[model samples]
Target: MEMKERQQLQYEHDLRNHFDILSLSRLDRLKHYGLHFAKYAGRLARGDAEAKSRNETLVDAFLVALSAANALNQKLQNAEVDTEDAPSDLAFTDHAGRFADACEKIDHLEEFRSIALDANAAITDWIVRNATVRGVDLDALVDERRKQLAQRAVYAPGS
Candidate 1:
């Protein structure tokens, strides 16, 4: 079945509820969001360095971006619904360093709250655009990922 486009906040809520993040304290929940963001941000930096647009990594980065928004209690609704494939932007250049730098600042996020949110949102856009450029189905991929996440052994079933 085809999945419809959803807001970034919907993704965040799905993740939180699916993973029982709602049960944790505010600080721990922030940590949870931050950890996922950091993990994918690092991976994205590496992938960008090689100029490889791995579909899975792109989705992961998108999810991480959502998590970053969640950590800051910000409404992130920048998902590009029904995006169509097009040529890669000619202006595309190495953004690995900037992404890595964003990850670093977000790691110590309290001091750079606003920018961290912006960086994460930017990461989300980059991932979507890159995936589209590579002729990938990001919505389908993310829907599959959401299913996998829901069934993962780590989380109790049927949360």
Candidate 2:
């Protein structure tokens, strides 16, 4: 392939990886909400207190945003553009500002999980795609580490 074509492929690969990592981060956040926040919201909604409904609504909105952010990050990471630097308008100050604001308002609320989940997913996805597009196997360096601990369990001294 021509140099330009190769470069284009590289860009695409990198973008996709970035998005995958981002998605991973998002998934983590959703998992957190699924485990904790969602229940809290449900409780508030069912409680007799007047503020409960509003609180639940707010929490629900934040959760939705968290999900959206995760999905978007995953898409970007999968596109291999993890480090492509989001445009200014899409930066945390912009796209995630609402999330940040919601987080600040939440005191007893659990820690926001969106960023962590999205980032991990984006990075992991990027690595996988990058290896494939570069015609290299990352199994030894990447997969080995991820699977080693699990594999070790299967071969434990007692087993």
Candidate 3:
């Protein structure tokens, strides 16, 4: 099964109310994505972070990017268009840096919204590209993660 960005966004949105993720202040949401992205990228780059494998870090980064994109109001309607091959030369750190720069610049431009959303899609594309190259079953991973999120929601303090 292919990893569909729109579907992933929908799943994140569905879990938003339960986790109060999307409702977070813009800076907080950006921090959420940034921190997770940095942590996972560190693990993937250094081969250290808990007992998780590199691919697991990749999945974490990918999911956070998708959720961050959605929080930034990226409609993800351009997923098909953005699915075109991203440059394979960039390292995971480069990918993480680009995403952080993108998110950070959202407040710096007069037309930053569109530009940031484009960056959001671009960042997601790079991860998807890496996943494909590494033969990671993103669909399966996402499915498992979403299920876990749903189950957690059941016992959420306010849910």
Instruction: Give Cα distance to truth, residue 113, candidate 1, Å.
Output: 1.7
Q: How many clashes show up per model?
A: 0, 35, 0
- Model 1, range 11-101, lDDT digits (tens) per residue? 5546554456656664465456556655554555575574545577667656655554555676655556365563233212223334345
Winner by lDDT between candidate 3 and candidate 1? 3
RMSD of each candidate? 6.0, 17.2, 4.6
Error of 2 at 53 (Å): 53
Candidate 2: misplaced stretches above 4 Å? 1-111, 139-159
**Candidate 3 lDDT tens digits, 1-159:** 333554565555456533676667876787567667777666765655358876666666667777776677665443343344444434656656766776676567434455456656666776677677666777678667656666566665545
Rank by TM-score (best first):
3, 1, 2
Task: Judge candidate 2 at residue 6 and give its lDDT.
Answer: 27
Per-residue lDDT of candidate 2, residues 1-159 (tens digit): 222332343334334433343345543444443334434434444547545543233323332333443343433333443443322212222323333433443443655445434543333343334344544434333333323323445444443
Worst lDDT 10-window in candidate 1 = 87-96
Tell me the lDDT of model 2 at 9: 37
Error of 1 at 136 (Å): 1.4
TM-scores for all candidates: the values are 0.59, 0.25, 0.68
Best by TM-score: 3
